[model samples]
Target chain A: MKTTFSLALAGMLLSTTAALADTTITIESWRNDDLTVWQQKIIPAFEKEHPDIKVKFVPSAPTEYNAALNSKLDAGTAGDLITCRPFDASLALFKKGQLADLSDMKIMSNFSDVAKAAWQTDDAKHTFCVPMASVIHGFIYNKDAFKDVGIDAAPKTVDEFYADLDKIKKDGSYTPLDMGTHDQWEAATMGYENIGPTYWDGEKGRKAVIAGTEKLTDPQFVEPFKQLVKWTDYMGDGYKAQTYPDSQNLFTLGRAAIYPAGSWEISVFEKQADFKMGAFPPPVQKAGDQCYISDQPDHALGLNAASKHKDAAMTFLKWVGSQEFAQIYGNALPGFFPLTKEKVTIKDPLANEFLSWRQSCKPTMRYTYQILSRGTPNLENALWAASANVMNKTETPEQAAEELQKGLASWYEPQQK
Target chain B: MAQDRKPVRWHVGVFLAPAVIVYTAIMIVPLFATLDLSLYEVRDKVAAFVGLGNFAKLFGDPNWSGQFWNALWNNTWFFVVNMAVQNPIGIGLAALLSSNRLRFAAAYRTAIFVPTILSFVIVGFVWKLILSPLWGIAPDLLKSVGLRHWFAPWLGDPHTALTTIALISVWQFIGIPMMLIYAALLSIPEEVIEAAEMDGITGMSQFWRIKLPLILPSIGIISILTFVGNFNAFDLIYVAQGALAGPDFSTDILGTFLYRTFFGFQLQLGDPNMGATIATVMFAIILVGVCVYLFGIQRRLRRYQF
Candidate 1:
């Protein structure tokens, strides 16, 4: 009995020493597709830098992530690092003290104010998450189909865009626009928001609307819906029932000429498309007009307030905000551009093409994301239906705009007045 | 005589204890808790008692009331579709299967009842794939029958989406009513049918006059079950059309609306108080329906001992 007790005491001492040497911290994320990338490339690089801090990436399905994370946080069983969805979702967590304030961290200096804006409090006094990546919105077109239609250059203006689409329709070989209304989000995200930025003049119009200086019924907002309605003729037959995947498949199969896309589609399109693909920013209203792109911050990383291994998690986050980490992640995931201000060279040509638009066009996030969607009858969801209905010819752009404005006015104090 | 009163029946309490405890824990407690939760509202992230404020908002606020009424209307249509199409078809199939002249009756029953055993996810996905305009077999199959122009994207059209989904649900759940009514039809004593035949009632007339009347009690039970089931339905619509029940929320039923409100969807935060209000309303609806069936309908239906 004495020998057994002595052995057990020695085992406990060894385990404690091991624990002191190494702290294993887990990260919770919704990006299940990035599991292999995290496991094979990212984790190894981080582990090589800090051997004392072992990292684990645990992911749930994207749709279930918010619910699962909320429940886990409530149960006090969440991981050390939590992947943050931009804007109000993460802001709500920070407000609840579930996410640690990262303002004091030296790594917070790496990102621009615009990059960090998503995970900050309304007053911008407290920053919560380390901004990671942003997806730029534009058009990804099949070069072969464009050649077949005899359109040598990407459209620089809305009129040129319609002309090119008409040429493609006349060619009778490929569908001009490859988006669908079935999923609803694509109608708003890729259809309206993609081209809407140019009409709204990017951040200028976006902030004005938020400040109640501009209404959705304003011509700038309504024009995007009008442009979206014009897409119906180019969408070919049975586009109403076409799902996101169907649209993707149609483009990759070389059946469609142009795809309204977020930059996130770059890697997938690169893998799937046999034809050469090219991207262009949203067309301007007229020649010499400044263009704009929806450069939305998609994801971030934050330290869990209840985490036991704060030091290890902070160390990991600091690395995530580093120039080296930016280079690696930017190259590793082509479409998901690193949000850091550091100049990271993109290896993928299509992604680089998408990145180049940042030089010419003003960048703005999706308008409905930040503070407008907090009330009943969420503006973002309302936009999904409105965008689809306009395309379906069920509701005119004027009516859709009026309805959205009225709904916003009902609850939002700024819009009410 | 007072001294001879029955001793305490400890075994009776023991026999009932487990079921009573389990039911109370799972069902009765949550039901009451949901009702209680509906009376509260979240203010500055703290749940404060607001009495009937949530109900008032649900019925009074334009945004909330519009969604509530739309969902209620859609749910009513969904139930109506099942009652009009599924139950009648189920009865017809059950009648045919119960007929003595029918061959391969067991095979037909198994084949027809197979869909009820499948998961909602599988059924929803398969139907979606089959009906898809881009890659689905629906258009091609129609073309082969020389009716190519007749085929449209039914599931994607706002006007047809709800009805199409309702029909798909009918296809899945028809087996349930069929099996129930089949059993009810089988349990009827053979002598009653012989007596009906002797009285000159035959064929369709015989079924209408004797079998259907005899099975009225079973039919009543099925109607109540369907009402409760339809009002509570969520899975099939969720799996098929998503949380928004797209094509302009044309297919948004009460269950899906409640789910979106309680759990939140996309960018919207979940309002548990509003969710609870919707749930409480749903419970009340189902309760009133069941009560009406019990007191008004079921009581009127004659149950034959034979």
Candidate 2:
């Protein structure tokens, strides 16, 4: 009896020691292709230095990522670290006391002016999400395709843009544009995000409108609508039937001349063999419209409130935002063009040019439909899904616009009161 | 029998307790809760009972109404496609594979069923890769067949997108009907077949006239199963086309619509109340289908001794 009791006591002590040794923190981020880097570089560096901490990184698959994050959040145990888009639910999650205020995490000092401002909340006091990366995604046209049609560059005015598109269509070796609407996010790119600079006129006015200082149907938005339709006309027969990536490939492999894509794709395109792709901002329209880039924090990381290992989670977040981590990612194999101020030398020439263009832009906002449309709950559902109807000619652009406004009215009118 | 069983209400309560508790907690309670949510409007991030307000917006508001109808119509077509294409194909395959002395029958069954074991996301991704014009096997296969012209990017084409996805779904689930009908066919004995032969029936006519009648019950079961599965389908569509079901929402189903509404994607804000309303709509739809089968169809199809 004595021996058995002693053995039991010894086992208990050993288990307790083991438990103490592992300060496991599950950190959630969208899946990174550089997972081996995380394991080899970040995990070891942090774990060895911290000694008392062990971090378990759980990456969400593309399809499972957001929904899984929200469900985990609702369950009150979404790991110690969570990955979420900067949106109403995440904002609400912050407001509902489910997230830690990382306001004091000295990581704020390293952020660039625009990056910091983009992440700042309504009050501008708390940063609910630590910035992972940001990109200025806008319309990109192929230079070679444009040159073949005897156009030197993408037009800077609405009239010239239309004339150029007409010329390209007349030449007709390939389509000038691919509407590729099968992927819903691509529909969002064409239907909504692309319209920002043209419609709202500029950065300051656009920000004001999203802040509810401007009406949904400002006179400024109409011309852009016309310009938007003109771009659609450049698409070949059955334009709405194609997927976004398909459209990109067509432009890349010399099938189509123009693809309205974001800067995130520059790195990917640079790797394509035998094809030299170049991008400039969407053409200016109606005299005042300069090029526009939608500047949403592509994805952000949040600290889970209910994590058992909060300290370790915070440590991981700090590491992810550090200059060293940024350097590793920025210089990785098939690397990233980080939206950070880490100043890592970009190896891809295309990425360097795109980043330079994004940096020099005088006017921009963190995307409108993604930000402004959130005034109505599940507004993207109606707006993005409504694009299908628009393509089928079942719903007119005016009808799509009205549906968007009505969704907002229903959602926000009550809340406003 | 001895004393009228004393009409034991207490015994009835004891017997019913476990099931009632389980059902209430799992299904009934959640259903009522979701319905209650539909009646309430979200206020200041909290819910207040608003009484048919959500439904009014859904039906009366143009934006909400259009989507509600679009998803409803799309969902209906999905079911129709399954019934028209999936059911007949399943029935045919089951009939063919159920024949006596079919060598490698088990191997064929396992091979055909392998897709059903895969998660919907996996199935969607694999099919997306296979169908993708970029790296998909379809374009190459077409080129190899001297019919490369036929490859016009099936998945990206809105006209063909939903049909393609439906066919993929059918490919995955054809096994369900195959298994059930195969079981039912196996149960109809050699003695019965011999007796039918004695009655001047044989071969193909024997299958159509005699064997098929005996398997009517299994067919009914398969139909109802298809209805429920079709109504609840979401993951594959969501994977192939994000929540928006793009190329113009041609593939948008009730499940994807509900998911989009409940868990806002991109710029959309999520509304749990409306999500619940959609869920309630789906429940009512499934319930009607089951009821139609139980009350209307099942009653007329009399069970046979064979």
Candidate 3:
């Protein structure tokens, strides 16, 4: 009887010892492609800072991430820290109280107002996540293509932009715009998002449209749709079949003159591009019109509300928002312009070129996010379809605008319940 | 007196139990669960029972019905293309390979079956590249044949995209029917062929009169399999054209549409209820097709015992 009792006591002690030694903090992210940075740099640096807590990086493919995260969240099996998207998707999680309230975190104070606002709940009192990176959207052009075509500078106006495209066309050697409309989202990202924000420059204007006080089919919105169609003319023959990676390769290989893409692509282009790469904001409608570059925060890290290791998760979140984190992010992941407001100067020339736009142009989130924050889902896909329709001449600009308004109505009516 | 008693056969029940349990758990349970989910509506992130509301919206609502009809029609076309193109070519190849004196028959059969072993993602990407007008070897090959002008962006054109995808799918899967029919053709008795040869019946005449009739049942099975597969095909289209199934959703099939509705693509939030509705509809479609094949088509095709 004494031996059995002693055996039970020993088993309990062994289990407790194992449990005490295993203080792991798991963080989930969709950026599996950047596993090298996470495994080799970020997690190692984090573990060094807190030797007691071991960081485990959980990853999913980007295409499957949201569904996987949502399933895990529903099952109450999500990781301690989850990388979330901004606006509606994050807002939904925040509403469900799935994310821990990070409003009281002192580290959040260092973040830019845009970053803070992006991850904030509808109440505006509580924010769930710490915004890590803001992607700058603009055209990354070949400087050699500009010089060969005898164009001195990146066009500041719509007229000059068209003129330069014509010169590049006249040069007869390169495709003016390297665009892959095959994915459909690429056009909406590089074309509509870039052009639409310039027309709908202010937040009030965007909010008014989403609120139904202003119409999406209005002339202001219609004009941007027209501009998107015009951009397609510059995307060479059989451009409809060209894919996103194919378009990027065309630009890097010097087959095309200009490539409109997000700042995230800078690191990739730097490694592949042969010639000098330059970037500028999408040219404005008229000569004097102020342009807005599409700037939205990405990979907002949130602590799961149900996490067992809340203190450890919070420690990591704080570390993620620190200046040291920004330095590592900017240096290792060069494309993303860090939103931490720290003076981490990214040495990549393409990154510098994209950053130059932030100095001169107004910053706007992707056009659909304004509508999406109001709880409209699939608005980006609708706009993507509309852009494709206008480009393919399947629908006129007016028709496409009407369709956009119709699609928004579907979301609006459903939400009214 | 002991010899008059019969032995108990408890092993039959024991052997069948595992399969029945597995099938019920994996297939039957999920199928019914999805059907049940179709009767609910998700609002504000909560699911509430809505009865026939989802079905009404699917068939009655213009926005929903338009996409539904397009997918149904596209799925029908996919099946029809496989039947009309894939099966015929497969049969022709199988017939040639089954010829008694044919050279390198094993090598030819292996070569034909190679693509069937490839994953949908690999095939989709490979075909997309081959059909791409830019950075593709197709244009140069066409030019070499003095048919450069005939080379257009077939996969990018809405009118051609669905057909192109169908053809690519057929190319990947034709080996399945070919092998099945080849096996069926080989099962023909040597005495029948020898007897036909004695009557001066040979080649096309012999094949048409004897082999074709014998293989009708295999062909029938292949058609049903193709119907089921075509309706369920999602991966290839998703990998190639993505969730939008563009060139303006020309390549949108039932599987892709169901996926988009359920999982939500891009800015869309996944609606499990609506997704379940689509699954229910797809189940009904597959059920009807299978029932018709089993009761109507398969019943008519006589499988002659070798």
Candidate 4:
């Protein structure tokens, strides 16, 4: 009996040592849709490279992620690896010391300043998260619908774009523009931000607005709203009540001509759209003008400050920044273009078309994402309402711009002065 | 001597302890904590006592005050819609069901009450689909009836969105008041009803002159319940219109406002201080409403003992 007890204790100690040898780190994410991709491909690849470090991808619904993660962090139960949102949301966590400073990490060298800007401090001194991927905004059109409407090529200028819309509208079968104001964010994101870059001259106007040299009421910003108002003329009947999914269905069902799209829609559209789909960057105001696109950095990964397995988590993050991880993640999620300095070949054709825009057009982040939205009457939320109102014909472009300017000037110090 | 003395009755305390402890832990503690939190603001990540400064900001600041007042006005309208439309319809349904002449009363009651048990997510999503122009049957159904023109995008229009949502909510909760009033009508002792019948109070007059007064207390209770529920309503609007309560925030009520402030929406970060302040204001409004019902109206109501 004594010999058996000693042998059992020894075995238990050996098993404990074996478990400790392989550090298991979990990743908290909002992308529940990507669970299978992480489990089947990404995790296995990482584990093979680092046999001693095990990885787990745990995800909650996107809508509840922020609240859920915050409570977990507070309770000291957050995962070792944290999937970060692009801007102020992650910055807040870093400020509270819930996320570790990854500025000194060797993997930080893999990304450019533009890619890291989303996760960096306002002063751009310390970086907290490793850049993962970005989604480019443009217009996706049904090729068959375009053909039926007697249009052969994507429009090159704003006037030409409207002319195509007019042709599509005149055709009587297809809705010219497949978009809606019911989910207000789309009105701002895929509607305003998608085209506003062309008018604002991309980063030039975006930076100017942040610097307080140019107000939202400026012509550069108001022009986009004016353009959005024009889009209402081509939208289908009852477009006012149509939702995001409704618009997607309308486009994919080949009933609509063009869809103002984010590159993220590529995977879904590829699967759903039976007809050949083509993408075009936002048309410039005139032919031969310099084009701009809103290539917003959307998601990234970071080390949780309270993590027990910091070294193992760092190893995973380092692998995440590698060319191998980018290729796999970029291909697995076609629309999510990896933000690495190293070149990556995209597998999806629609995504490739979106990526091709980067060659000709200048890339800029969404204007309100950074410091401009930190104050009351949050600029991002205001833009959503304003954009929706503009599209609904409830607010004129000038009025919308003035409201935004007034709201910004209320608390934003530079704007006030 | 022992037999003459009163028992210690320690068992009574034991019996009450579970409920008292649970209630205090879940309800009382959170209520006081929320009130306490309302008095402080977080600056530089540290919570400091601000002593109603947040309230001042909520009221005095144009930005905060604008949203607060808008939400408050919308909440009042939601309650008013429930009082005006839901309760009357409920009473009518109950009166019809209580009459022995009506057949399959149980089936009708069950059918009407079915929506009350459905989750808000299902109700919101189902209604959205039903009303959608792209896939919804609303337009087709209306067209079949030659009333297609009447089917505007009510959910999408800022002018009609709030009323549409309120009506949907009324549709779901009408059964509550109906069941309550039904039970009240059934409890009217047969002798009292018979006495009214012999006095030549029959048909509609019998309902108004005899039965209505007796159920006045139940009606009052239903009104207060509707008021409380409407003021606290959030899920339907959130699930339908989203956190911004958009199309120019026409559907925003105090509940959504508090949620957005507390949890933040999209790129906006949550501010617990402002959230607590808004919550306290809601608490005060609810308290005042309940107080008026209890002291002003409920006190004056005559409870019939037939």
Q: Tens-digit lDDT track for model 1 on B170-195?
A: 99999988999999999999899899
Task: Give one digit per residue, the lDDT tens place, for model 2 in A1-417.
Answer: 999999999999999777757878877766554467568766787777777677777776654566667777778767887765655546766776777778888886777756655445666788867777655555566677777879886566667767877888999986877666567566555545665565575676566655556554455643444445556677755455456666767766777777777666665566562566666665665556456555555556778777777766787788877887666655553224455676767676665655665655554654443355555445555555555455545566676666655566665543222
Better of 2 and 3 by lDDT: 3
lDDT (Cα, tens digit) per residue for candidate 4, span B21-124: 99999999999999999999989989999998999999999999999999999999989998999999999999999999999999999999999999999999
Question: For model 1, what is the error of residue B82's alpha carbon versus the real structure, in angstroms, after optimal superposition?
Answer: 1.0
**Candidate 2 structure quality by residue, lDDT tens digits, B57-153:** 8878766677789888888888888888887887788888988768888898899878989898899888887877655788789889898778765
Model 3 chain A is weakest, by summed lDDT over 10 consecutive residues, at A370-379
- Candidate 1 chain A has its poorest 10 consecutive residues by lDDT at A62-71
Q: What is the lDDT of candidate 1?
A: 0.91
- Roughly what TM-score does model 1 have, to 2 decimal places? 0.96
Off by over 4 Å in 4: A1-17, A20-24, A50-54, A61-63, B1-9
* Of candidates 3 and 1, the better by TM-score: 1
**Cα interface RMSD of each candidate:** 1.4, 4.0, 2.3, 1.5
What are the lDDT scores of the predictions, listed in order? 0.91, 0.71, 0.84, 0.92
Query: lDDT by residue for model 4 over A1-417, one digit each (tens)?
Result: 999999999999999667766789999999887888889989998888778788999999776688678778878999999999988889999999999999998878889998999999989999999999999999999998888878989999999999999998888899899999998989999999999988888999998888888999999899999989999999978887899889988988888989999988888788788999999999988889999999999999999999999988998899999999999999988889999998788888889999998899999989999888888999999999999999999999999999999999988888876
Q: Largest DockQ belongs to which candidate?
A: 4
The pairs that clash in candidate 4 are: none
Docking level of model 2: acceptable
Q: How do the residues A1-417 of candidate 3 rate in per-residue lDDT, one tens digit apiece?
A: 999999999999999666645779888888886778788988898888787688888898766677778778878899999897877777777788888788998988888677787788666788889888888888888999899889999988889889999999888899998886787878777777777778777455566666677677878788877987787888877888888878888888988998888888877787788899888788887887877887877768998989998877888899989999988888778877789876888888778878887878887777577445353336777788888778877889999888877767776753222
Least accurate 10 contiguous residues by lDDT in model 4 chain B = B264-273
After superposition, candidate 3 runs with Cα above 4 Å error: A1-21, A341-344, A371-377, A413-417, B1-9, B44-46
